[model samples]
Target: MPKITYTQPDGVQSVVDVNEGDSVMRGAVLNGVPGIVAQCGGGASCGTCHVYVDKDNTKPLPEMHPVEDELLHCTSSPRQDNSRLSCQLPVSAELDGLVVHVPETQI
Candidate 1:
């Protein structure tokens, strides 16, 4: 299990042991963390799972796919250099202790 943390807009943090192969969005949604609706499940069809990847230890994440990029641009949250769709992030040994910041809101 990898330890992943979700920083809320109010600065509260929810940390959980994300099972390997599980999407970050699924871990958050299943754990009842706020700010990630994951409306399209893990299909990358919706930007509701948008998050801002903290620069620290972010290099391990996969590059943004064209679809994810397009969807991020259309999200209500302001697009950021670190913007990522949580559903696009899969838990892995390389992602141990990963930290993700939940946006103010997800559309």
Candidate 2:
């Protein structure tokens, strides 16, 4: 399992352990973390699970797929170089301590 830190828009944070092979959005949903909506249930079709991965750690995450890239452009929050859809991030031991910042809103 890998522990991920989720920082909500209001500045509250939750550090949760995610099972390997599970999506980061799924981990947040299962743990009741107050940021990710995961409207499409881990599917890349929805942009509701948008997150801003800490810039320093972004390089370690897998590259964004074309579908995910396309969906990110639709996020309620502005997308940045560090922006990512949590649903597209799979957990792994190498990602332990990854940090993600949730936007103020997800439309």
Candidate 3:
């Protein structure tokens, strides 16, 4: 399991131990974390699971697919340099301490 930290816009944080190979959105949804909606059930079709990868994370994440890149433009919040769909980020040992900031809205 890898420990991932999800921070809400209000600065609240939820630390969860996600099973290896599970998507970040799945981990948050299962743990009742209040930020990620995952409206598309990790299908990469919706931007509700959007998050901002912490600038402090040093490990490299997987490359974003073309569909995810296109969908990011539709997020309710403004897209950022670190913007990513949580459903596209899988849990891994290398990303054990990964931290992501959840936006205020996920419509």
lDDT of each: 0.89, 0.90, 0.94
Per TM-score, the best of the predicted structures is 3
**lDDT tens digits by residue: candidate 2, 35-67:** 688988987998999999987774378889999
Give the candidate number with the greatest lDDT.
Answer: 3
TM-score of 3: 0.98
Residue range 1-107, candidate 1, lDDT tens digits: 88889999888999988889999999998899999988888899989999988877644888889999899889988999989999999999888888889998786
**Rank list by TM-score:** 3, 1, 2
The number of clashing residue pairs in model 3 is 0
lDDT of 3 by residue, 8-78 (tens): 99999999999999988999999999979998899999899999999888976999999999999999999
Q: Is candidate 1 or candidate 3 better by lDDT?
A: 3
In model 3, what is the error at residue 28, expressed in angstroms?
A: 0.3
Q: What TM-score fits each model?
A: 0.95, 0.95, 0.98
Candidate 2 Cα misplacement greater than 4 A, ranges: none
